[model samples]
Target: MNDVNVYTVTRLTRDIRLVLEDTFQAVWVEGEVSNFTVSSAGHTYFSLKDESSLLNCVMFRGNSGRVGFTVKDGMQVLCYGRVSVYDKRGQYQLYATKMEPRGKGALQLAFEQLKEKLYKEGLFDEANKKPLPFLPMHLGVITSATGAAVRDILKVARRRFTNIKISIYPVRVQGDEAKHEIARAIEELNEYNRHIAETGGEYPVDVIIVGRGGGSLEDLWPFNEEIVAREIYASEIPVVSAVGHEIDYTISDFVADLRAPTPSAAAELVIPLKHDLTVRINEYRDRLYLSIKTKTEMLEKAVKTSRDRYVLRAPMNVFLQMRQQVDDLLRTAVSGISHSLELKQRDLGTVTGKLQALSPLAVLERGYSITFKDGRIVRDAGLLEEGDILHSRLSLGRVTSRVEHVG
Candidate 1:
């Protein structure tokens, strides 16, 4: 019994864990995901199951943060990790380092997920979009300076509008550092514009064009990043996204104020053709000149007609005619005054008759005599005192009498 090898539970578990981890380092496992959950600490725990068996898996936050897409139950996935055992449970599980969807690429899945997310958040609403200027004085461009995109833009700009001021902010359009660089470029350009505004400097950037030449999804991943999308959304200056060919669409395109199919198209959109502007201006000038000429010709005709008339060609005849008009007006005014005076006299006669009918003298003529004292009509006889001189008014004349009794 003493010669027999002895193994404790801890020793057995530790030996198994080391063996599994060593042999299964960086093994690739493909299966349908189930029982997936993300812990509060951001670690992901899930089970990968086949038709016959199930394997437990855990992705720490460090590795899970790098995953581009959401993982859920019932979704087929491919996981790369090393097998390890938990000492507490004595169970073997996979410690995943990387994960990807089986059918779609990681970046593509990530893009779709982020688009849905931002759309739900109202970031992609048309109401939030800024309007591009009709004619921008200065333009800001963010792209690879040495790439074909810059060349295409410059070529279009030269042909379309040569006087527009353009400032280029060179940045990488791919790789790990590309997104950061692109975001920083947008921010710096905005800051520069702000500085120009505060200082009232000339040629401040009116609009920005963020773009790149056509490339694979992998190459264009930088523009698809959420950071780039947010930066484009936050930009005060209107942003025109011109990434890749017409077929390509990135997150930046969705968030930008406008999206052009290519960099050349972006240039054509922002810069109007000088020749076309000149043609329009010439049309306007011609129309204005024609209008003025018509007005002048009308005025000249009016003046010539005035000169040909008797007024300007014969001054004495015009004066004689004016004198005759004045004499006619004077006669008309005299006739009007005589007719008005006759009408007023007739009206006055009628008014006098009406006033005479309403007068107290009319009552006196009807045999009613009014008594007056001290020039006022005596309405009450009790107001008269003895020996008071009362003037009794009759229809013909006034009689002066003395008050003898209070009757």
Candidate 2:
């Protein structure tokens, strides 16, 4: 015991770590992943197991970022790192510097994973896409300043509509920093639009075009990044993705409101030909003028026809016909009244003759007279007294005398 060396737990772990790290430094291991986990700090922890044995592995945030593809349990992967020991856990593990999927390229695997994830989150839904403006007066573009994409867009836009206003935000279209720059450009343009809308300012960007010239998948990797995809999806203004030729598609393409095959194509889609619009306006104006003229001519013809009618052309004749009808009616009324008066006169004469025949005057006129005593008619001689005064009514005169004999 005195001759042998005693090692503390820390000393043992350190010595083992140094030995393993030296023996397996910069190694490549192949295995299926299990017990995979990522910490909030972005450190990835997992176990790589072969058929017989398992090895614990750890990847810190710095190295994990370059891994390209997400690591999950049950995925077969190739890891390059050195074996090391954890002092606290007294465990030996692999500190991975790089990790890649077994059968696919790192960038491609990452693209597929992110695409599936965002698609499941509904970022690619057609309902989420905004409708592009029929005519965008102001456009916001994000691309390399000297790239062919910008030139193509400007040329096409100028040719189609000379008055369209374009505001370019130059950004790196490739490399590690491209994703951040692209995302930031989208955010700034959105903020600019919001500011203009809130303050009622002029020249608000109606649409945004994010694009680059056609290139390989690696060259276009920035647009595939989640940061750029999210910003494009959340933009207030519509985004037109013109990332590459018709054959190339990026994650940005799916999330954008519209996808154009090229930057020139994007301009063609957004801007209408000024000459065509002018022609349409002139056509509509001609149609309206023709319609009004036709209606006016029809009205004029109708008025002329009305004026040519006999009643309207000879108004005095209409009045004369009305007056003649009134005079005829008046004559008929007067003739009817005269005939009625003659008949009435004949009837009155007949009535008068009949009345005279019924009166006592007719008897007197026939030479018979009426006698009265004391104002009463003396129809009976026995009603008279010898000294009574008598009156006689003749046809011509009346006689008053004293009565002497009753018989």
Candidate 3:
């Protein structure tokens, strides 16, 4: 007998159904939901259909409660579940673990999920946002090399501030490689800036603007990616997001230090207005000129008034006053000399009178006489020898005499 044994056709079908169910159980699909129906057992059945194909799907009560919005027919959605074959009817269908409205496409949905996750982690907090320099000498731009965004930004910035310096780090703005390219460009700019600071060179850039022009949600999806957001948040330089139009918002905008409605607007915000600055300079110049003129006029008036002062206005009167002072000084000197002479004359007369009072001629004139015995004047009359000769003296002459009596 042959070793091979044949099984019933029912068993073969059952085995095949088990494999099909396992395959469907792990797959995810996105499509519009149609013919959605609920069973009495609380199970949901819906057909997922794209424009060309359709797949049967099922959601139990547990997964249905977790859905964000109501599930309805003709609604586009994403269903995540596993393929399974119903053992009773041997039909394959999707066993959904989760379902969501298809408002955002797959890429955008991934972006939003990452953005929400990072935001919760505080990477997009305003507290961590860096302030851009008011007057930046250098600006870094991260965008596609050939994109219109770069051109628009350059045009606006050049017209606003001709002295601004720009460095371009060109990268893909869309497609599979865009996210990595943008992230790398931002990191490179930061690294370059750090190196410049370390090496004592000019700062690499004062601000950085990272974005591309407006596009469909899918085309602008890279700016909304998590990697780009993290790079923008981590950058040391101030970052300005200029992705899409005013109505369109991206993750980069939320994570950036500043958000501009358009690329041209971003340029305007970052660069100063040259014409306005010129007007201010002219105004200051005029003010300084006026101040100098006013001060000069005041000084000139002071100088003219000083030149026309009282002394200068009457030259002869000033001379007359000086001459009167000189005359007064001469009169004082003459009076002092005359007074000194009179005092000296009075002192001389008194000395002369004293000399006269003590003079012998004055005694003679006063009728005083002197007598001498033996050629000597006698001061006393008590002692006299007999037969002594006496002399008499007057103020004008002397006489000789002899003494005869003793007393």
Candidate 4:
């Protein structure tokens, strides 16, 4: 005789799940997200895979709803969860409690994801970008006051154009709050422009330069933020993005109306050299004078040539010819008027004969008298009543009578 013990498949799966849950109560796993989907119940399901292995994961609505951004397929992510086996399906999955992006920093991943999103939305289209002015009279700058970017920009601007007026809006260049400051600065500058336009104020800002000195990626992160990009895109004034060095590109550069290699480059591009502009203006003035002189000479030559012609040589002959033409036109006009009057007189005579044939005075002259009551002709003698007053209009005048008998 022998004693034997066996467990059902469900019991075995339950035991495995309990062991997994106990060992991996809270652990972090890194892999790329695949087959990501959200159910109608607000739960997320996906597979975490790397080159070596794959792990199925489920994030409930309570945790998934807290994720700051959308979960897309093929996104590398770090998952924090407990591992357990599903008894019904006989499979294991990571019951993820929280998840963050992997490979790239969370903020950076968010920036990249947002960049692709906005780019698809046509925010980075060349047609939507505004052109920079050739020479901006009033420039608004937004950056840190003590930074090298501002100093370089100011120095370059002063050197390039001595008369350029700059209004600097000092803000934090790098920090958690830097993006907010930059966004508000852009919005405020545009609003100030609108206010100036409404109030008819002088020296309104025409262009805006928003950036900071070169720094590390962390130092330049504010410009990569979505809020800063949105603000730069929404600025009514043209914006020149000069964040970091030429090699260092940010989201601001892609969304801005213009991108300068450096802060000094932005300044140099905004205005032309005073001496160069002066020379150009002088050259234009000289060309204008030459053109006018040549035209005037040609006109004078034409006038001289015309004076040598027969019409201008003897102006009295031209005057006599014009007078004869005018006399002919007047005679023609008088003849036309006389003919029109004769036709109108004949039509009037015909109309008068017709009118005389239908005149009420002609009927009265024929010995017929019109009797009226209340200014209406009395043709029906039966309609008349005794004692009613009647008016009999004869050929000479009207006679009033009172009807004494209806007969």
Backbone clashes in model 3: 16
Q: How accurate locally, in lDDT, is each candidate? A: 0.93, 0.93, 0.85, 0.91
Question: What's the lDDT for candidate 3?
Answer: 0.85
Regions of model 1 farther than 4 Å from truth: 50-52, 313-328, 335-407
Quote each prediction's TM-score: 0.81, 0.73, 0.54, 0.60
Q: Candidate 4: what lDDT? A: 0.91
lDDT of 4 by residue, 1-407 (tens): 25755778988899999999999998999999999999999999999999999999999999997565667898889999999997889999999988888766666676678889899989899999998888889999999999999999989987889898999999998988999999999999999989999999988888899998889888998898889999999988999999889898899999999999899998988878998999999999999999999999999999999989999789999999999999999999999999999999999999999998899988999999999999999999899999999999999998999999987
TM-score of 4: 0.60
Distance from true position, residue 320, model 3, in Å? 20
Rank candidates, lDDT, best first: 2, 1, 4, 3
Better of 2 and 4 by TM-score: 2
Tell me the RMSD of model 2 versus the true structure. Answer: 12.8
- lDDT tens digits by residue: candidate 2, 234-331: 99999999998989999999999999988888888888888898899999999999999999999999999999999998999999999999999999
**lDDT at position 235, candidate 3:** 88
Q: How does model 2 score by TM-score? A: 0.73
Per-residue lDDT of model 3, residues 250-330, tens digit only: 888999999999888899999989899899999999999999999999999999998899888998999999999999999
Clashes of each: 0, 0, 16, 0
Q: For model 3, where is the 10-residue window of minimal lDDT?
A: 104-113
Error of model 3, residue 104, in angstroms: 5.9
> What are the clashing pairs of model 1?
none
